[model samples]
Target: MSNIMETSDNEILFIVKSTPGNRQREPTESDPVVSTLHNRKVYKGDTTILAAEFSAKSSVIIEWKKNDFTIYKESPQYHAGQSILIINNVQHCHHKKKYSVSVTDSKGRRVSSSSKMKVRRDSGSKISSSSSSDSDE
Candidate 1:
């Protein structure tokens, strides 16, 4: 932290407003200091659906807000051309939002993607899956 010399009342107030990094104002005599803000990964905009091939079907759990939307919860059976898309309906989630998708391996670990997508409106487009055998010449 750096010390500030009292310039003017307005300038000093502006400096207080522009503090860098995480912030939690000192508590008043009766109240405890509180900083409830968290930095969470966010996606913006309508997402796209793409074609993919899955060896087996598993439940897809989405954690947004206080709700979790699921697919094939009781029965994890996803077939070819299955859709996976995110609609931008959540607050602060901009259009064509970016999400960090975690695909797990059989070992129960996650695999992250290094790329992001700029997609179309959720309901306007659909994502499907496709599979084929690998080929080598």
Candidate 2:
């Protein structure tokens, strides 16, 4: 497969579909860019979401992992129809490690849609509290 557009850290906007052995249609920014993975490179203590999208004729597979541990694979997202993978990593947080994801076609040819799994140590946290009875007293 050919990379019609350079991968971007920003949100993707378009994808090109071509006939076999023909130049794929160059998608303008207006075309929908389907993604099978998001935040592919997440850290152990970091919690994020994974998601993707596709058309009626397109299919995808998502494989995610931490180190050598396989977290997910060839998984179907958003039921068995439109492709989407939404993964909340908060419950499965492990030792700080880089997460990986691989996306492919039904025939196993890969498409370039990778991301950085990053964790910020000092990003701070949100604390919620009501008026404590002990403190109120």
- TM-score leader: 2
Tell me, what's the RMSD of every candidate?
A: 22.8, 15.0
Kindly list the per-residue Cα lDDT of model 1 for residues 1-137, writing each as its tens digit: 22222222212111111112221243232322212112122222322222211221222221111121221111122211121222322223232223332333333433222213333233422222112121111
What are the lDDT scores of the predictions, listed in order?
0.23, 0.34
Question: Which numbered prediction scores highest in lDDT against the true structure?
Answer: 2
The RMSD (Cα, Å) of candidate 2 is 15.0
Per-residue lDDT over 22-128 for candidate 2, one digit per residue giving the tens place of the 0 to 100 score: 11343232332334333333333333443333322234554445554544554343212222223332322332344455545555455434433444344222211
TM-score of 1: 0.26
lDDT of prediction 1: 0.23
Question: What's each prediction's TM-score?
Answer: 0.26, 0.38
CA deviation > 4 Å runs, candidate 2: 1-46, 54-58, 75-95, 123-137
